[model samples]
Target: MRLRVEFTTEPFDLDEAPAHAVVAREVIQSADLDAVDVGPFGNTAEGHADAVLAAVDALLRDSLGAGATRISLQVNVVAEGHK
Candidate 1:
């Protein structure tokens, strides 16, 4: 199964990236996922279910440990025909 995950770690910083945001980005970028898009307000990654789920686990743990007060996320199963 293919999965797509969209997430954000809160305690927003306009001047610079927060520690939690940085950690979240690092986790997603390093994970065995594809179609990763990282932005100031949000981030998304797509890959097989296992890879996406593993990344989600790491992202939550690392970002929270790095001082994220809140995290918003959504996971969806991508249809085979969809991109």
Candidate 2:
């Protein structure tokens, strides 16, 4: 199965990206995933279940350790023929 993960690490920083946000982006960008989209307000990645899950695990751990006060996330199963 394939999975899509969408997330944001916060205490938003308008002047610069926070450490937690930077960590979160690093986790996703380096994971064994595809279709990654990292943005100021949110981020998203798509890949096989294992890859997505592993990325999620690291994203949570690293981002929180870097001091994110909150994380908003969602995961969904991609339909068979969908992106």
Candidate 3:
């Protein structure tokens, strides 16, 4: 099954890339996920269920460790072509 994780870090400028955001991207990419999209408010990563979960966990840990005050995460693990 595939999963998607979206997250937003707070206490940092939403307009520019903060350290936490950078860490999130690096961690997600390092996990070798299928895809990761970064938007103005948050970022989204989609891939295998296990990878997504692990990446999300790493994202949270690293982001907070990188100085993120708070994080809003949304995780979806519905297989493709589902209603």
Candidate 4:
């Protein structure tokens, strides 16, 4: 199934936000999931959702450790057998 994961947070400056973006991409990659794209929105990331919940959990832990104030994530997955 295909999924889309979006992450938003505060304390992600333009310069430092890239670091967080990289972290997110790495998480998805580590999970053996395809990262369609990854970028920052003030302090948010919007793109492929290969690992869904697992990726989100890891992202939260990693991002928070990186000094993020607030982190919000949304995952949309395509159900099986639904084409």
Candidate 5:
């Protein structure tokens, strides 16, 4: 299932930001799932559902670790036949 997910984590160390994105991309890729598109908007990622979810997990594990605080993650999945 494809979806569009927007999520953000607590402000991270400046140097670790790209690490976050990289980990996210890596997670999605590792999932061996479909990749329609992906990009960064502030701290959020906008793209495929499976990949985005994978990215979220990666970001949490890599950036925030187990102590990560909850922020806000919004997802707007384009309905089938709409995209």
Candidate 6:
């Protein structure tokens, strides 16, 4: 199975996002999973469900360690369809 995920962390300041966001972004990008897109509001990646879930877990831990009081995440399971 494949997945798409969006992540947001707070204390959220639209103008200047917290350091935890940056750390979380790096964690996701560094994962060996497929990278579709990434941005301040959210990110999108596709790969094995296990790998994606692992990456998400790691990201969460790192973000919290970096001082993220709260996080918002949206995950979607995508079917392999012709693009």
TM-score of each: 0.96, 0.96, 0.84, 0.61, 0.46, 0.84
Write down the lDDT of every candidate, Cα atoms only: 0.95, 0.96, 0.82, 0.59, 0.53, 0.81
What lDDT is reached at residue 49 by model 3? Answer: 86
Summarize candidate 4's per-residue lDDT along 1-83 as a digit string, tens digits: 56656666665677655455567656755663443455566222233444566667897888677666777776777554432
Worst 10 residues of 1 by lDDT: 74-83
* Per-residue C-alpha lDDT of model 3 across residues 1-83, encoded as one tens digit per residue: 88888888877685778898788878977886777788768788888888888888888899999998999988888678542
Model 1 earns a TM-score of: 0.96
Give me the overall lDDT of model 4: 0.59
Q: Which stretches of model 6 miss by more than 4 angstroms? A: 81-83
lDDT of 5 by residue, 1-83 (tens): 55665555554556554555555445545553443344454333345576667666665676555343553566667665544
- Model 2 lDDT at residue 31: 100
What tens digits encode model 6's per-residue C-alpha lDDT throughout 2-51?
77777777887789868998888888888878855777777677777888
Question: For each predicted model, how many residue pairs clash, with residues at least 3 apart or on different chains?
Answer: 0, 0, 0, 0, 1, 0
- Tell me the deviation in Å of residue 42 in model 5: 2.9
Error of 4 at 1 (Å): 5.0
What's the best-to-worst order under lDDT? 2, 1, 3, 6, 4, 5
Q: Candidate 5: lDDT of 9?
A: 50
- Model 5 lDDT, residue 50, Cα: 68
Better of 1 and 4 by TM-score: 1
